[model samples]
Target: MNAKTPTSPVPPYPHPAGGWGSVKALGISLMRDGAPLATASALRKQNKPGGFACVGCAWAKPAKPHLAEFCENGAKATAWELTDKRATPEFFARHSLAELRGWSELELEGAGRLTEPLRYDADSDRYLPVSWDEAIAGIGRALAAQRAADPRATVFYASGRASLEASYMYQLLARLYGNNNLPDSSNMCHESTSVALPETIGVPVGTVRLDDFEQTDAIFFFGQNVGVSSPRMLHQLQEARQRGVPIVTFNPLKEVGLVHFANPQSPAQMLTPGETTISTQYLQVRNGGDLAALTGLCKWLIEADDIAQARGGARVLDAAFIAEHTQGFGAFAQAMRAADWSAIERGSGLPRDALERAAKTYAHATAVLGIYGMGLTQHREGVANVQMLSNLLLLRGNIGRPGAGICPVRGHSNVQGQRSVGITEKPELAPLDRLAELYAFEPPRERGRDTVATCEGVIDGSVRAFVGLGGNFLRAAPDSQRLAAAWAGLDLTVHVATRLNFTHVVPGRESYLLPCLGRIEIDQQAGGAQTVAVEDSTGCFHASDGVAEPAVPTLRSEAAIVAAIAQACLPPNPRVPWNDWVADYAKVRDAIEATWPDVFQGFNQRFRDPGGLPKPNAARERRWETDSGKAQFIVPPPTEHESDPSVLRLMTLRSDDQFNTSIYSLDDRFRNVWGTRRVLFMHPHDMRARGLAEGDMAHVTTVAHDGHRRELAGLRVVPYDLPRGSVGGYFPECNPLLPLQHHAHGSHVPAAKNIPVRVKSAVA
Candidate 1:
């Protein structure tokens, strides 16, 4: 889907292939489980004292300290944590690891909660139940053996669900073992954003808070659909629209929900036929064409400012702020002036008039907010695209003020926080220095491998053991065909999760599945109930305490698991106080407070509110943290801007019913996709050009860069309203078509949004 193309007017439905799969599962799940017991537990936990943060999305504004604070996904996360089901020792006895591997991702997870530690017995192809002591001993032995062989062979992966305490301990253990090979999920998704943002602004997080939506005069949404990705945000957008704030959208596909969202919170609106008009103007940009659209907008705004100044009116560009806080304005402006309008129009798939109109709308606004998602970041020029966004916001002095700033819609709840707490495989000197002083041990100074590098390491035998906190690393990564093969080469593989996922099925020579506590479950230790801490997208850290008890008595919290593993693998690193921090998360928070006093003040006390304090952004206040104390702009070298007629640009999309890599069901009710994930949306003109028609099965193959042949089959082409030479399809299914090496120009983020491919009709 080209970012410049208008979205299809028809609402998307549940994907037929996957939709029915989810419906059947949901129906049975609801019937068997009844109402979630976690609801009662969560209600009790809210405000009686301090409540735990919602573990769903990183946008943790402190829970309103109210019962309604939790969203549906958050509730599901809670319910899954608090369910009555259990995967006990007996269950493992009945099923082998081989047998579990045969199960589908959804079925395996749906089986039940993990009740005991299980180790793979390759002789029988089964995972036999083992005592905790034995499991720890095996882990210790594995680490000892591997470190003796090669210290850097071990990679420590952290899931975002791991609380601050667990993540700290996890990193400490890795460093103690003499390696910083931490390849967490953050590496796969937002590492590029994290790396690029701080260089432009001082902070990697969004400068805008939820409250900013309340005060904004206009919002420019790029490549983000709130209703599907972050439904909780719909309430905010609906409120903003009701207040007469204009909502402008730039996306290739027209998301129906963005146009006419029925606020589930509004009873009357929910019952009425009318939907809220979200976008006053929608610009359809080409897939991977965001930089051009952004450049065009910036250029148009500059020209408008010149006109305004000549007419003796308010200036659109913040000349003084740019002069004081940013560098390279002259070069940026010069490049913009020199940029060809014809090139912009052709590359963006949007007309010059449309670009000018959108720019004029932005220029007229008193306050503006620019929000984008993976569509902008998962491209060849992802980092530059982000830099361009920062440039646009700076042009009007739109950041660091009330109702104006930049917002990168994060996927996971604590992804940003995980990065903050040293989850990165590539850590800078400052954090390492702080860790060295705080932990008393010299942390690994060398940069470690990221997700891409980690995969390469695994394939080449440089990495022996892979320990994941949560998530299905194999399924979520690009080039599943190759990743699965690489996993077989590992010496040891451990997955600490609540239930079955794809990672558990792909066995290493020695594998272990350790079940841990979920966010909804109560985690009790010697000191009454335990409270875990997590940071949200806005950079506010809050404590999250689970209300309901663990699904089974045998389940342990991730923090407890990390501590036990640390104790097993490495000698005591007293500087971290891993054991004490694991015992009570508050102690960890105290340590964090001690380490970084400038940011998190009285960290434990501030979480008592509904909305946490805003994280600081240097760019927002015209305070540049760069070398020159000025934000530098890059005039990216011009590249060929032609889209071949034979190949269409494919943008991977998630259905409304999906969350991250987890597909709740195939039904995208809003998008009208029913019971199918293997479908593509195309423009009628493109279909006619290729002699293709709707419902035709086609094999989509990518143009070769490194002689990698990637293709998907049996895809029905729905000739809907889409931009010419652009198409849309769900990911994981199309993942095979994306080469592992085909990533962002510099960041190695898989260019999931923009891949050039040719479609051939499948022979009957």
Candidate 2:
């Protein structure tokens, strides 16, 4: 490796996920942010019984949380939000929007927190400071004008990072404005699970809780890179592995954390060279082959069950559970039997013997816990992909049983909670009836636009206003360059955020950036201090109270911003006491209980409990809420993107040092990527087949053939342990190569995992 390589010479990080490396990373983050002492105080309160929830991942905290409950990323997030650095008006005045546009994601966010509201000045080509009142009032006026024309003319987007109170208020505000056009970060992540899980098990979320992990006989991981996405989960995994539980992993890449873990919380393990092995069996399936692989598992199980029953051996399938609690089993069994072994092998990139061996592991286990992430959901057949997993779970009566259920690893802290609290485009599920009765206003009943539809609306001139709660919308989107062009046509864009992002720089005609407090910052109001609740991936609604002073005095809570904007947009409504709720979040919780009595019956009281109340999952108790009043076993259609040797499957990855769109640094230690984000990972044989070397630069272009041109050039190819025809690259950068129209079948989430691409030589 020389200067020509342009990347760090270090090989792939050989160490486990969480040890001294995590400690070093946290130290660097605190040092870089200049918030060691300040963040230390915040870190002490992280994930505690009466403290703030971690913004790093949506994983739940234990009943008795560790003294230092936060993970490396958790500490980094705390340090990031509590930093002394500030991107005040002076910072914006110095950099023109065009100049800022050229900056990297890390460079943009590294400038620190936004301290004041800013309005983009076209004349000066910079953001000019504006009072919070004026900014909120302007947004209100724009929404009013949009409402006068068409309620759907404005779309309100919520980031999964906001609290439940904020999301409830945000959705209410949107509905009160005469439209249900609410889209959130979930549209880009686990919307598939929200659809698939409920259809299969009568619940949209995971049924398994923390205690279930302790009882499971076996664990299956699909698609989620827990090490990078949620390393905190590694503790549970490590404990399960140590308990002699059979841990099986199904992914295109054998991620480090899934392979092994060195628990940082344990001194005995961290002090030694030894690391605990996590996965007993690792299956490297094809990029778009998870559905095929899952179908193979079902096929193996059905055949094995028949053999066992005929031979008078012990039963392999849960006959009684299936007969009593489920429907569609016969059709599901028929599909599995009809599936060709040859087709399964080709589609799954696994031989019949290998799948059968893996099936044996599942068949032997009485109870199994299945978990998945974006790898399964961000595909054209995402709904089917998840349904296939549920099919397997049903064969063994996994759901509603101890240590046996589905776990969809969600991104963004409260993304799941956001949907739970009515942040959805579906009219029937938007709490319309209760909201209308409570507020004395008829709520919108028509279906609203999702993420994809919003993009179409942006281009067609149907939507004129864009209000984003938090997170980088433009960069996180697919066909980003195209959407950015259309975004400029919007009449107004308002971003409520704590820091700068690409969305802020890609301003609309009258763009306004309203700074909001982070989850770990003090949110004081008329009630002295405010505490909001966030629901984790497992449906634990825990309170998050900021311990540190806010990044700036001008910052407002997310709920407060939503209230002010709503007040500005609509005339005075005595029924909806927006001001009162903002002053005391408890009032907002009380409203939540009234709006959805069944789900949050004792919201205010339960939310105040230190351990937090775990919302009931009917599926956990073998109760089906589906139309048929029984669990379902759906059979998915054949894969549309069949195997093509010439076309390489390109899946996007998140660098360990980054979150969704916020890059903490350039290096990704887990993957051994350093000093650059332009590197690509592929199998060595595949690299050789393309006449490419390890360090050779290549041009990657999408093979979607959707009449849309997309490509990435000057990327250094690095031979790694991926499937033969599949390659990987970091997200957002590779995001340009993903077609906006290419999305999940039912959920419409961007199918980014297995994109058809051609890696050609760039040395012309």
Candidate 3:
């Protein structure tokens, strides 16, 4: 199905600034709004026995056991949570839901923390305050009514912000109610990586430990902007750079943070106005060209290894490891040799010499850390892209070794945790078996809806009630207008959020906005202060608590909210200990321990330490988990197709200044964008091809196979140093161009990164 994209109807602001001026403007705005005074105190308290978890990115690296454990974004996240602003019942009384819906997402949520449970009243076109009991009862009634008809009609989605206990309860409650349709934010982002990783290895997440970064001889950064996408990781890269480790960066656009960065922690550098030069060399690749680049690299390596082998010398490839642990090298080798250099160079936007140099570098490095992000995943061939990267790593025996493994940098702080705790749409039998053993409930053996499927269900009238843990579902979904309309069509809708957001503004037939305590807020239950465990990308789970009082007196923790709903909806399900689990989060941890042994032993006791134990990465010990007990090389078949002559491959990206669906401000200083998120960055030649100049307004139109047209206009075209035929724009705003139906093959994740669109000069 196709949805019409919005016409840039009117320029967000005429005469928009470009170049360094835009960068300076954004920097000033960032310093003004991004600086946090309470971050120090909050971080200090974070180390205390009951400090809250970070509400920011889901990198669950423990806030360094002592001192403040926060990056710049973490500080902003803390400030965002502890802000004095409040969206009280009185505020809702002043503005009707209809009026609020018209407000920009930035304005609607920028107001502040939601302080009460709100129920939308059609007569008043506004949400009126309701008691917690009343709201829970309403949700329970909605679920009961819907379940009585069709259990699959209800969509229960959880976001990363929900605690481990809370997410567990959410799944439990949904299963008890007879629906396993748990479509969470993980599906929209890293679901592809999660799905492919396990097939390649035995686990779904990255295998690299932080310690490995220190020992790595070389690192490859792909399609990720460390400076903006993950700032905390920049320090680690800086350290590696300082050690003189060679770093090769591949991206369509040259990110400033990856080029040179000034670390706040380096005193000598701070005094000397010094900067850490991150990438020894950077390769400008085209969007959706990652597979091509990987193939070229592997091709060069195979040639080198063959030459060495003929000379009766050690092969450049990991011959011993490959012989012991892989199955498909023969097939892969043939594909690599057959891959054409012209196609690789044209598709990747890199010269053959540059590709060879990168290949030589990888061949020389004793250990290499390969890191990739959404740019590789958001494409028609995202899964293939991952499999190809896995092949590259395996060729040199990069897996099951120190300082080497594929790392998909997750965005949310506990996103990895959410997946670990069973918030996935596609539940693995092993995890489900463990869940059944721990909770004593036989979870439905049937499959469930992913993000795209859930949206389709909603649109096709198959989904009745929509309950979201903490995401901006409508905004986060592709085709915002269709998603909003479908959401509005739902029989009942519930949102548990810490702050006000655009999702809260859109009303359902029976809509409820339940304000939940933020990560920074204290969650004092009947059992007294409680700490929740969160798992990081590296598989380390640790406890987090809160120091400050609840942002609002009426607010409840996600655990409490989930439990209350479960108690109210499911009719006394004797299969699970719902009440006990929600009361004391420890009970939840106890269950987690039962499900996954050894890793979470004395789960509560281990959390007391400043350092948490890292989970096992088979690669770390040279134990390959693939079928042959070794890393396997996969040579994907080439797509015998040509790019549309009229369109270019456009990648939708997040700005350095914003998080997923959470727009702090309209300033992307890293990209030199200020006071706007509507502009598109492209190469000067691409702009010239369309008769568009820098700062010239243009219309972006997408051509669907069904002859439907989706377009956005009045977007100021800015010439960037990006690869030709490649373009980049901010997400959500550009989400409309991505069809909900356009997703990866295995997981059905929308290709938000690789969209083909034609550009033209805007009329007038």
| Candidate topping lDDT | 2
- Those runs of model 2 whose alpha carbons end farther than 4 Å from true positions after fitting are 1-12
lDDT at residue 443 of model 2 (Cα atoms): 89
Any runs in candidate 1 off by more than 4 Å, and if so which?
1-49, 62-67, 89-102, 309-314, 639-642
lDDT for model 3 comes to: 0.76
lDDT of each: 0.74, 0.88, 0.76
Error of 3 at 202 (Å): 2.1
- State the lDDT of candidate 2 residue by residue for 569-665, as single tens digits: 8978899998899889899999888887888978887775755788878999999998899999897898654556789989999988888898888
lDDT of 1 at 295: 86
- Which stretches of model 3 miss by more than 4 angstroms? 1-37, 45-52, 60-68, 437-441, 639-642
TM-score of each: 0.93, 0.98, 0.93
lDDT score of residue 359 within candidate 3: 94
Give lDDT for model 1. Answer: 0.74
lDDT of 1 by residue, 1-764 (tens): 22223233344442221123333433443434334445545745632236666656665453353345544455454445455666677876788776777766556666667888889888887778888788878988887788888879888887677777778677777877888788777666666677677777766767887778878998999888665666567667777989998888889987765675654444575455545777888887878788888889988987777788999998889888777777788888888888889998888889999988888788878789988888788877887888788888888878777999888888777777777666777757237777778778877777787788887788778888998888888877777777787888899998898877778878899989898887767888766688777777667666677766667788788888888888777776666666677677888778776766666677777754556644556666767777777777667557336556797889898876556666656666656777888898888777666666666777788886786677888998777666788888886668777777878766788888888888877763
Tell me the number of clashing residue pairs for each predicted model. Answer: 49, 0, 15
